[model samples]
Target chain A: MLETGRLDHNLGRMGERARALGVRLRPHLKTAKSYDVARLATAGEFGGITVSTLAEAEYFLAGGITDLLYAVGIVPSKLPRAARLVEAGAHLTLILDSVETARAVAAFADLRRVAFAVLIEIDTGEGRSGVLPEAADLVEIGTALEQPPYCRLQGVITHAGHSYAARDLETVARIAEAERSGAVRAAERLRAAGLSVPVVSVGSTPTALHARHLSGVTELRAGVYMFGDLFQAQIGSCTLDDLAVSVLATVTGHHRDAGHLLIDAGALALSKDRSTADAPHDYGFGLLVHADGTPFAQELRIFKVYQEHGLVRAADGALPFDELPIGAQVRVLPNHVCMTAAMYDRYHLVKNGALAGEWTRTNGW
Target chain B: MLETGRLDHNLGRMGERARALGVRLRPHLKTAKSYDVARLATAGEFGGITVSTLAEAEYFLAGGITDLLYAVGIVPSKLPRAARLVEAGAHLTLILDSVETARAVAAFADLRRVAFAVLIEIDTGEGRSGVLPEAADLVEIGTALEQPPYCRLQGVITHAGHSYAARDLETVARIAEAERSGAVRAAERLRAAGLSVPVVSVGSTPTALHARHLSGVTELRAGVYMFGDLFQAQIGSCTLDDLAVSVLATVTGHHRDAGHLLIDAGALALSKDRSTADAPHDYGFGLLVHADGTPFAQELRIFKVYQEHGLVRAADGALPFDELPIGAQVRVLPNHVCMTAAMYDRYHLVKNGALAGEWTRTNGW
Candidate 1:
């Protein structure tokens, strides 16, 4: 859960950043899969929301967020579902990194006599998805989408997911620059091939925050910035206090000999992300905080976790077990807010140390 | 999803094994969180069921699984909910690993005027929860539960979770024996103190599968075997072919340069449980299979995953790219079924190459 004040602050910061950078902020709604948060994030508009699944696309579309980008690679089997969203008056956009998927999208659109807007995904050094920006495959995919009456190349989108592994700002900025340049170059190539690649998008929380400028980028897409996590904090994207989301858990037991406190939150509650394992500050699973979402003791962390039990202890062995007795409620700042938040069905919102409201979120594909 | 025939085989094997060991099979419904599966696992009896959460307890109770044991350590805040289940004619059994919790349960029962059946969780080397068998704390917890008219000392329960880390059958057997002996010893100590400790429960998927004997153990509570995973297969608990649960994914794209196939299933669909990282066979995130759940390639696996994209590649550089083309359906044998299944609302069942049924599941805390 997050305090509305802090959440607003986080959202305001990102919104301001997008304004200053002169790019449309198409916030990815995958992280905070809540209609309430999305409404606040997009400032209550259908203005270009990004989704990772068709489920999310449908969810947000039903909530009146009709302008959606199903950001993952589009497959033929899922074309009908994506088409249904488009049929329901959603300006849905599909992305693909391969010509095969592009052809499939073309075929599906041709068969169904439906117009489909698509983006060519560029590999901006992530080595995970997309075609290399300089590769001939990028032009091939763009050409494949451009050849039909039903298919049109909307733009090129790239994600610098590798930016999270950057240890310093200079590296993050460099990766961000690469991400921006790669997507821009791919878009340029598509334009050179006589295709109207209208939109250019690039982002990842670290890269989005560290990018000096958005030269050819038209819109910024980032999700985790709204709910900063320990991984982002360790990477210098956000401060520890900037983290908005925290899992409220009850202390189940205390082991005097082992010098630890056990909480109800575990792998199921906090998730076994461990994204901070190689970071500067390794919060074992998550950092322990007061019920009001402040650090309880210096360097306290959840050192271990089972399916339903989290073993909390001081990192430097200062031993705060006596203070955190059984039945104590503590908030755990997650290592990855996206994964942690996926476990809970709703958010128990707090504002200035008081229960404000509860917001329900959707999950699964 | 699982093939019904394979699931039946897995369930029947475990049931037969429990019968052969001369113990009651109290199948833990933590893995398969479906009423359809639970009914089949328990063979249509409210005799006993082990759950990891109160959500499961309430869910099963609604479906007539009355005899339930919450395996997680009981906390004071959760007592009212557990008491409600008991009040609703559920023969619920509560477990506590601490004297403070035992006293809290006693107080809750005493105040409510309800006699609660309680078990002292014994640490059979898992150390995650439970009192050590030889420790005075075990007897102390038992003594606290023995107070008249409030709580009755049911017995002791231990889980050999350490058995998962065991590399050999002998080690797993030894851990299973330790689990049995530690729990039996705790029960014996309670009996020595004139407490009528009636039951001794112990299990873990690996331990339950390999245990040669259960001399004094009254019941074995094991989950995951009903939906065997790669970690269990790597630990030699079950063969790879015996795994029942798998994520049905569609190949969204194929990157020729990267020599990998991208699937729609990623962290959200398959979950990010890297439990087999240190195992003999590191199946990456999960092993790739055909539409009918047969291995596509001998060593093909989902190498890396994003939020909604899975990068699947052959481990030995023998790519099967052409075989698994775009839009092709594939089943991924999960690293851990419990974590993977937690993401989906229902299991897409297949029996003998046909869609049999879809079983809905319970999730969240």
Candidate 2:
């Protein structure tokens, strides 16, 4: 379930932060795949969004959002779908780190007779993907994208995904600077090689929120900020009050002898993303709260989860078994909202402690 | 993707095993939510199946299978949906461990004028949900269900989920015996109280496959065995060759400097289930294999995963980057097929090294 009031507050705060940083907030829709949330996130913006999958790109395009960036590395098999989106009037921009993929994209665009906007992914500090900002392959990939008449180089992009490891704001800011300088430097190198680099993008939820300055960045992207989770709250990206999404579970069984409660939300419902396990305050799987979005007097956490059941116990005190009987509804604020939200097909929107409505989300590759 | 040949072999083996053990194999449909797989799994059986969610129960009912055991604990809020399924010509059996849920189910059944069948969940040492076979409340929950005119006691059921933790065949068999004895004892207890306990069910993939004797158990239930995973393979439940499901991913990027390759299947596509993390030979996130379902010479595994990218590395040697370039397709055998399969809405069935067709699955509550 999603608390719309908290969602709005989170979205509003991120928008203001992006505005203050003087970068277009092209909110990544990967976290919230719902078009309703997308519409709200891009409410006063230019409707430029970032997607992790081609399905999201298609879904958002059908929802009347034109500008999109397929942020994942492009491959040959997915180009046909990308071409279809482009043919359907989507300003789809694809990203790639390797020269081989750049060549494949160029060749595919030529064969399909579809113009493709391409971005070279630059490695900021995250050793996950992308070529290093100063690597020789950076210019090679840019040059390859410039070869085909149907393919145009949009610029360079980088994500400081390692910013998620930041324990303090200063670390996040440093990662943010590295993200900005890396993308900007990669774009500059491509420009020096007589290649056009129009866009320079960089972001991650923590860095986007704490960046000292995005001097050379044109647009910033962040997804999880719109739906704060325990991991983000621990990493100083968002506060506990900013958490917008949770899994509404029913108390199904009570193991008073074991001093725990069995909830309907388990690994499948809440996801096995133990992202907060290493945080200072380890929320076992998630923090349990009242159905009306209020924290319990005792800190209850889902310590263990099976495929279809979660074991909830108080972190330091006894479980309120008397107050929470069988069939009682409780909400679990997930350690990672993206993983938890992926389990549900739709969100039961809550407003003013009442159910507002339901919003569906697109899933899968 | 699902290999139909392996799937058929797995179903056939489980069928033969159940026949040899003198028990009905009410194959659990929770792992493979597809009616197509259910049809194959129950080809010559009585059509009795088990589900973990009401959504699965409803979907299977719509697909022409009626007998369903919702193995999760029952709650009041879900009774209306169960009632609708029962009214839709489903013999939906609900399970609960507490008298509170049993009373709620009875009340809901009476209010809706629906005849609900219920089973008492016995904890065969899983310590997850379910009551102990010797618990005093066992008879109390049964009596509550017997009071309502619209509610009936179907039997007693128990799952030895802890068998998954067994490191060897002997331990799994031992746990299986405990599972069998527990459910039979619980059924005997209910029958001693003048209740008609017609069913005594016990199972888990490990228990189902390793049980030497299921003396008093009428039915066996197992889900993940249909699509064996690395964790199951490591626990001696099934060999690696019996694994029927795998994630088909495209190589998106190559990080030779880091001695790893990136695939499109990441935490979202492959799931964050680290079930095999503690196994003797941990398969990381998943074991990477060739597109033809053959293990690579280097024994590649997806060691790290982001939301949309899985970092594949060799277990002991250098990555075969020359053979696996960008856009190349590879398959990953999941550590836990149940969690990994939940990420996809459909399965691309493969037969004789070729794409056969697609089977859609029902997901969510």
Candidate 3:
């Protein structure tokens, strides 16, 4: 179920978009968090995987995946894991933005006589984790890595996470272009300093889809595109039909007085991730769907979430909950499918309305 | 650690309060989401347990723990799992507000002879789930067990989740009284109908702590007390020291431009569950703690969360963040400990500044 239906479509579209952009599609596995889904993603394609966790990279490597990028910047406490990945002969790229990190990685790798690929993250106007675009010293520090004991400077990557706040697709497009241009400019600045920037990466599912024409961006690293969620749908990146995952739930009780039906799948099952709530259509928890993959009537909306119960409210503040039986099974399309999927250790796949299989997930540092 | 310093103390006090009110505390297990901590809680003299998911209940029961209540109102899709619990000789209490569910459970249980201690969920105004207290027909429906082939009714229960919004202890106390009175009144109505109402339960962590007496309340359910978080603390309910568990993360990168350090712990590690953000001193994500569990320096705040990256904003707001050496391990106190812990497959116990044993968890339905 992890690699079914719209998942394949999304994966194909991402690859196609990458080809059209003349860049490598470095789809991060942190989105699906499923080995089966990752396998489908890499199947028959020259895919360079990006992972936020060492466990994910290790999972892919164990499955014969060689090209991988530990995209979430590495810290000193888990440097040993990064060194191990490089030692295991996996083509690993590490993300870092500080001279202190560079010095530490260099010292550790020098001791092991193994040089690793490192990318200095650049902040492209997004006040999140990254070095300032004008901070050329940060890039120079990466390039100054000691050969035997240090990491080799790769290119730079930027994630315009704030692009989701754009009011329209036009603004999102502008943000995407600016994000790509920023990373490219940083890479150009490094190249002028005589360093060969191998990979210029840009992220954020919204920006990636919109910035396919941004030429200087060598590789597109986007997760969550595999599972179009309320976030993606809200940003005008995908339609509801594009979503590949949904939380399976059951109607527990009906409030005939207030007009709502309680469901077993609440925040516990659906996750309390409301990252996309800022979007125009901010459903609190998720959109309720019938068991057959079709969404329920528009009258029903999951408006409130408790630790273990979801309150389905009607559009007009009255629950027409009589439409659902007390025991009917339903699927809830969560606010952020990436966070929602991460909550579960496995995915229960349904294809043609039949239980296909269970695809397990791995999680750790 | 589920049973940590300040949170342990708070839960202890709340338990005492509940016991004094003549309500046996069957605290929900969904909050802390740890068996070791829960076992420790039970060892401290809890009478029964309330679980949101059957998976949790099964995990506890298989470990020789019993007296369980599947508190998230009964749904038809999960009837078989509930029946299985009854078949295993576990004293199970099921919650549902509708006769439709009662009839369904009755039909399913009649065959298994699964005599369930069903609790008629009364809506005492938190309004997430349950029948309204004035829905007098609900009591008749519960006592109408002879009309069904499925399950038996035990009594009534209500959760005043809205008490969380109280501005002070006085408001929390008032809400608690109302909640207790509402459930008691419903039970009275049931008794007036010649129905033998065995248990009249009402609770919420805030109410359980502030309310002096339960009046006619027989049982208490409070989960978050075991591992209180920022949201709890913000309601003047718990303090910073009371946060039991935190996601121990590694400092991966520092955003100099944003004056923030990046940690591996993000929304995926620490849940985005901020129910009381409308309150004063609404902490974002959660407060960060040092290795020894003391709060991080005032300059450091976990301001924003990506899927797997916590942007630790520095107080100075400087773009020259190259000070912190990479690889520093930091522990992040979560917004809601229970939901955050649920995202992880296991717990890495940090006791006396060292990694202790690993505690595994069961996921899914």
Candidate 4:
């Protein structure tokens, strides 16, 4: 077994923070990727978790973790799997943005003869998936699906993912405001239309942390906060101190001529997700840190990656690169922790920079 | 068992035509994330398999899919795993660009009593991971590592991954030519220095299919052929028919105001790899096809995605989207097949749109 290198208080801290924030923390499991992390997230009062993949829902649901939300846009290819999860007695909630999905999901419910709770995805500002802020018919149609007596419309949810691309915290705050308002608006519209809207939710690591107050929001869905990434640091979501996750990479090479160091963490380990803004910063895949988690002064990156090798470029711009000793182990702060983390299968947990326990990541459909 | 949907052999057959043209085929396994597909590529006379993740290498190698080349740049975080693979007696080759990696590998080999064969990465014209065309001494130093002798310096490998962002087919082809020629030139210079460099490798799916000849190229590395994504079609690398892989999704809802369809595939299922290049045709997140494998003239995208829902926009630009009935199954062609395939734990094999068998995807650090 890979030795668990550190003790992690991320889940415990996140759960406590969620309680302090006054919202039901359905912590998105897409970030931690570890069953132990999810378990920790649920150990206190946050008994429910949010999952991005069906496999994650299944894994957590089977590992004695319950109150699951399969929080992807609902489609038909995975309805059977979703139905199976529901059949296995998972309090599974799925999200949808259209009527086509309603019909498909209803069909699955009819075939399986099980009732399902689904959230209507409303686009507050993220502009990814959801009904528009003005689209009341989306709610009507979704609530009308309750006529089927099998598919139940639970409430509405939105993700302020656009907060990640925020120019500053103010923009992130505005996006957060819009997201909660949007979910509240949809929920109110449903209630005004005489439908029971129980859950009003909004999420995003940025929005969740800085949304100010829950107000109309009953559930806060946020991932990636548990493991801070380079993008997170740039947006001022958390300081380098709060970054709970990083790829434990080994320094494999030194380019003496270029004054560059090569690492094993490449686009595969560190995802290819660069900041999607016009003025992208030079956090090469992530901040390359020393093994003890102290920041490495050299502005370095596992930039220019190939299938296996990371072309580490020093931002300090020295030449004849050979500085790092061979066989030194390093940690890479991923550009986007969510995407980078989704690439790995398990986490070598480190608590206070000491070996903790192994936390296996879930591979959800 | 998910169906192994049947694909028209037209595109895969074109791959055969490329083989006839003397362009050696070495398919990358990052796409599809399946061993069955790897076996098929071998059956298709794909010379060798290129892997981005060590999990893939372990899976293919253990499954008797030897002759594996981990296409990513080698880093230290994974050397122990490499040693394990070597100890298991798999003929694996690693890639790197700097002497630091060489020294690290050498030290690790010395400590572990394992010999790792490594290739010096070259930055052809792509400006990715690689030694410059003039870095001969660096290669000498790496090749001359005598202590503990952890790694053996093989030849050189380069990928014109940036070729994917080319303007047109001609530019892509030109980049492809430069990619192979640059590696060949570097290898020749190394050989002139009395270095016994054997492998002169080059690749990138776009460059692999477009290049006229390997010339001095000893091996060709290509992935994404088994599943031609929307990006490949944009670059004119392969036709829609050659796309062998897709996320079989179910329609979950309809966005009436935006004429959008909601799907079950979110970023977790489809991945977030938007091809760097803009395509000639408007292919959304993926090409939405009927179960029969025929595509519609209408262009649709899983445009705005939430955790569980994929918001698909219709080409018609009209909301109240009426044609697509609920409870229908659709195949989502990915923006990039490799990353998308990695999201799933297994391929629900489909042949002729009928259930074939479940081929599990392997995973680990």
RMSD vs true structure, all candidates: 1.5, 1.3, 2.6, 4.7
Best by TM-score: 2
Candidate 4, residue B209: lDDT: 71
Ranking by TM-score: 2, 1, 3, 4
lDDT of 1 by residue, B1-365 (tens): 77888889998988888888989989999889899999899883336899999999999999988999999888898999988998887888998888888888888899987768998888889877778888877778888898777688899989989898999999999998889888888888888888888899999888888999998999999999998999999999889889988998898877777778788888878878999998998998999888888775468898888888899888886677778788889889999888888888898898888998799999987
* Candidate 4 lDDT over residue span B1-365, tens digit each: 23333233533654674565565566677765567777766676644677877888888887887777887667676788888888887767888766656666778778888877777788887665577767756456545543434566677888888897786878888898888888988888877776777788888777877787778887777766566767777778766666767787776655454456666777667776656335566554566777556786676766655445577876665533455665577788877766677667787766765666788776544
* Tens-place lDDT digits, model 1, residues A58-81: 888888888899898887888888
- Runs of candidate 3 with Cα error greater than 4 angstroms are A1-3, A146-150, A297-299, A316-319, B1-8, B44-46, B146-150, B296-299, B314-325, B350-356
Task: Provide the lowest-lDDT 10-residue window in model 1 chain A.
Answer: A44-53
Clash tally, candidates in order: 0, 0, 17, 74
DockQ of 1: 0.69
Q: Each model's C-alpha lDDT?
A: 0.87, 0.91, 0.76, 0.71
CA error at residue B123 for candidate 4, angstroms? 4.5
The positional error of residue A90 in candidate 1, measured at the CA in angstroms, is: 0.3
| Regions of candidate 2 where Cα sits further than 4 Å from its true position | none
Model 1's alpha-carbon lDDT is 0.87
Sequence-dependent TM-score of model 4: 0.82
> What DockQ would you assign to candidate 2?
0.81
On DockQ, the candidate that comes out on top is 2
Candidate 4 per-residue lDDT over residues A1-365, each given as its tens digit: 12222114455555665677788888888777677777665666648889877778888878877688877776666778888887788988888777766767777887788778888888887655678767846765565557456788888888888887786878888888888888898888888778888899888888877776778778988777777767777887776677777777776655554556666666566666666223257675567777888876666666565434567776766622344565677777777777777777777767655776666776665
* Chain B TM-score (model 3 vs. true structure): 0.92
Instruction: List the lowest-lDDT window of 10 residues for candidate 3 chain B.
Output: B316-325
- Looking at chain B only, the TM-scores across the models are 0.97, 0.98, 0.92, 0.89
